[model samples]
Target: SGMLITGVTTLLLSLLVLALAWWASIRGAQMRSSLPPGPTPLGLLGNLLQLEFGGLDRALMKVAQTLSRNWGPIFTVWLGPRPAVVLCGYAALRDALVLQADTFSGRGAMPVFQRFTRGNGIVFSNGPRWRTLRNFALGTLKEFGMGTRSIEEHIMEEAACLLGEFQATNGTPLDPQRLLDNAVSNVICSAVFGKRYGYEDPEFLRLLELFNDNFRIMSSRWGEVYNIFPSLLDWLPGPHHQIFQNFEELRTFISEQIQQHQETRKFGEPHDFIDCFLDQMDKVLAPQDPESHFQEETLVMTTHNLFFGGTETTSTTLLCLTDSCPAQVQAELDAVVGRARAPCLEDRVRLPYTNAVLHEIQRFISVLPLGLPRALTRDTHLRSHFLPKGTMVIPLLVSAHRDPTQFKDPDCFNPTNFLDERGEFQSNEAFMPFAPGKRMCLGAGLARSEIFLFLTAILQKFHLLPVESPSNIDLTPQCTGLGNVPPAFQLRLMAR
Candidate 1:
């Protein structure tokens, strides 16, 4: 009887503990944003369980499409306990991004963006710092011949090296992704500092490795957690902190390069980005003028941003485009642009069908499915919904590009949308592959030059070999963090 009484008491205590924990979890969900319609949240976990953490891009699109159909172009969803209003389709996105540009000006430094960048860089910084850095980068690119012969020459060099690498492979099956990443990123690196690293360079390899880590970590589900629960994460070591440490090492390397340029001190000729920066630093650091936007901090941050922002994005887009498009694109490209001619921006104009294919790849794959996670600069009204300042806004690029009303089949890979009835190239306003507005890709001109040139260069040399294999290509994008993808795979290069 005594043992039975002890057993009963222990059982009741265990039951009570579980019940209390359950109640706390349920009650923890306090955020009740009635701004727009979305799936119901579950307790303290919120809507996290609703997401397809394994395959994010597909999951996001499915939810976005369903929500848009039911709620129209604007809807709100919980990213954990936090409420975010996502903009569906281009009309809504453009209204928010372009017309209401200033109102959506702030790129609120989420905990992760803040910890990694300290709000120093262009990708994360807001307010006057962002404006100044952006304007300076713009002017610097112009001085460095972003659209002129200089940038063209830099791209051609990288292209030539890439072509040599592919030709050396002699029609073997190889993943051209890393080589392409290195080649494309090296262009920005060369511009920033007057050096083109050899393929085997240890530092260059490490930098690539670091960027890849950031890419995987940035787009993962846990990344969202870190962004939200920074206070908790700060106490313990986590991927967010590790990533920041690694990224700072990258910044340190750039700082060393800047120091070298300063010591050498050749401002008049302006050999590269560093040289130009040194020249500006001289003027900005004058005794007469104390407070300056251009400082060692800005220089390091801007350099870091360019390397971080300019690299992985362009490389990933190209990698996915090649994977998403049919192998026949290579043959079609070969017939249009011969091997004797070098691929240029002009080639994109000449090869209408190839251009169409490229455009479609960009449209269907849509790497930045959510575009950049934006923060409202002020309380604003859109589609009759009120969005308060600091609310996370996602411009839904995937939904807009795949809207059936815009294209015959928004989901299918048809190049006809980019081609006219007469088989000429046509431009669509609906296609904002890089996302639009003030925060649109800073390296737009440079990225365009590289993509068109690199794709044409490869096609001029090799045919993308088709297979008797099953559809290895999944136009479905895999989002590890906030990014989505064309499913991961490799290709074979055959000489035409």
Candidate 2:
């Protein structure tokens, strides 16, 4: 009789706890009825089971289409129990990201980046840290020739070197990935490290290859899974582990650079961003302020952030642009600039077709479909949803790029999208390849300059021919999620 009484009492306590939890859930849901509408989610798992099969970009689009029909332009989706409010279509994204900028300026937690950076760098930090780093970086970069003619000289020099490499190929088919990587990486290396590496330098090649491998995996399905369910996937062994390894290797490389700068850097006369940062560190470290973000680890991560951002996306876009419509680009180059001198930024206005083609390429690719997730800094009302502080927000960039209201034939790749009926370059408010508002890509100016200079220089010297027939060439990306990575193909740089 004593044993039966004890068991009955324990069971009653358990039942009481479950009843309380159920009551709390119901109460919370009732309180948040004004929150954006979404499909009812299973506990803890949320919508992961529904999103497992297709690319996250496509799946999200489908969800947006289905939910927006009932919930309107802005709706909620539970990414593993955490509710993320997505801004679909052009108007919704522009309103949240541009109009209410400060409230939505907080950077969301990107698991892959957070694991590596630990909230240190400009790319993935929030609040005061983000403002400090971003301002310092912009000011320092401007001093070092970002968005200036001084920077164009650096890019043109790299372009000349790249031209030599292509000339060396002797009309044979070559994989342009490594060559393009070397050229683009050199431009950023000049700004960050105060020097550029030789194309054949083993150490530089290894670092570039590491970045490439990480980018490939990061865009793969495994990378998407890691982003959505980091805690669950952390223990499970997979290619995601390689991403961590690559990050460590990159960290080591950056550490070596910082150590060398610390030992050799001269005061009052800084050469690059690292030197400027060291100068700032000297001033700030004297006070030993607890809130100061000038630590050595921050330096390493920021350098990696700049280098990684500067290299991959620009090079990948060049490859895709050249592969997609080489003949037309070359024809424009021949007509306008001729094959006499390397193309410069000043000529960008003169060559309307070339400018339009580059713009079209950026629009067509939509490299970062889901712009970096943002967070609410405070409790805010956005598009009828009463969102709590720290709610994750996604600005669906692809929706803007593909909005029918903004461009004619949004799905098709046509240079005319960026051209007027008179055949001059035209700008579109919805053509936000670099995104818009305060959080727009800092390197946008540099990237546009690089793409223009390098492609025109190459076109001036040689014709970019594909290994396969033009009819057989496909422009679909190999992976599509956070970023759309263009498919790899060899090109014959036949001398013109």
Candidate 3:
């Protein structure tokens, strides 16, 4: 009797397992039918197997480019079980993000950030919260002189300090990573915290390391896996947990700054971003309105977004300049602005070749290639496909940067890509390094100014002598996921 009961139980369990698998297949099929078509996904894994986990950003671009040939420009790919609509080539991206901006401006779930942020910050939050914080941030940043001549002065001051540091190296080959990080970070710090740290300050160095480590890990395969399976990865041991720990340390630092500001700040007088936010909070937070978004946590997260965004991307771009030293740009700099003064924003118009070189650097490296993921605000028709509200969208920014139709020989680092027949700097509609639409990077103006000022300032004073021959210097990124991390290289800065 016992033997017979065991057999019957085993048979029932098998039947139940098979039934569940069948149901999942049917459900997945229904979801796919509603979305645009791509390579058929396997059970549970979706299209994950098709991607190269180590360099997810490049792999996605390659896969999309190949699949688009058969699947059209607007097609779907399964990131785990979630379906994301990818906008390939310049036309597809422009049509969706520009022509129909509002409909495609919603923020999507990025499990890595979602876990820590919980939808509280400006970058990840959707709906009213995002709008309120974004508007407030824009106003506050402007007041701090983000896009004005005042901010340019701050950047120029920082650049002078940076040149001193490089000169201190005495033309020895050294990695400019940390020094560049410090210079770029100080610019944002002056606005956000109303102060700057010495380059060798231990505490400041520790904080920058946290930022660097988090960016690198988040741009590795470990980050890709965590985003795909956050719950499972939480139980497993890995380097990804370091990301949260770093976030906690960063949050603690920001909170401490907020506390100090609260103790020192006056009611009507504001000195920096933290002071402005505190002033706003005092006016807005009421007992009747318990769900106000201007709480302390929001302040920390928004400040974190500004600090991190302001520092990492710009610094990485500066570091990559080590690999590129076009003589024509230097010649333009020498002719237009002599060594008597430093390069300024006004110099960009006068030095067309130098301006073109900077544009080409951004276009060639294509940092943040995948960009922050976007979602649909409402049910909308894109091309021939009907995408319901809240559908995930992935804009392949690198695709547009490398779009052959928009740029000639897009793969190479040629300044002529941004120059016209008359050798004048000509702007292309597809030159969107910061992405596009309403949700585009708020710091775009500030970032562009920094890249132009810092690069020209450095080149004007020092000659970047790469350790290896220019032809042999590799421009391939160390990793490509959250951002394209330039490979590790050292260069000597000889005083010109």
Best-matching candidate per TM-score: 3
Error of 3 at 456 (Å): 0.6
Worst 10 residues of 1 by lDDT: 25-34
Clashing pairs in 3: none
Q: lDDT by residue for model 2 over 1-496, one digit each (tens)?
A: 9999999999998888677556645643663475688777555556677775326777778787766779887887767656678888889888888888888888898898899999888888888998999999999999889522399999999999999999999989988978998999998888888888999999999999888888788888888778878987999999989999999999999999999999998987788889999999888886558678888899999998888787877887776655557787778878888877778899999988888888878888888888888988989887667888888888888888888888889888888888899998998888876778777887888888998998889878887788998777787888887688778778999888
Candidate 1 residue-wise lDDT, 1-496, digit = tens: 9999999999998888668546645543433443677777654455678776644445666787766678777876666556677777778888988899888877854777677667776778888888988888889888778422488888988999988888888776777768888898889878888778877789999888887777677777666677655776788766666677787788778888988888886667677777877778787888887867778887888888788767766666565545445466666666776667777776677788777877787787676676777888878888777777787876778877987878978867788999889999999878987778889888887887787778877777776663324356554545545565334556677776
Tens digits of per-residue lDDT for model 3, 1-496: 9999999999998998677657656777998888999878776577889878867667777877776778888888787767788888889999999999999889888998898789988899999999999999999899869522389999999999999999999999998888999999988888888888999999889889999998999999999889887887999999999999999999999999999999999987888888999999999988988889899999999998887788888877766576555466778888999999999999899988888888888888988888889999999998899999998998988889999999999988788988899999999888888988988998999999999999999999989888888778887888889888888888999998
- TM-score, predicted candidate 2 vs. hidden true structure: 0.92
Worst 10 residues of 3 by lDDT: 318-327
What would the TM-scores of all predictions be?
0.87, 0.92, 0.95
Task: Give the higher-TM-score candidate: 1 or 3.
Answer: 3
What ranges in model 3 sit over 4 Å off?
1-23, 146-149
In candidate 2 the C-alpha lDDT for residue 297 amounts to 94
Candidate 1 stretches greater than 4 Å from native = 1-34, 42-44, 54-57, 147-149, 235-241, 287-290, 318-336, 466-470, 474-479, 485-488
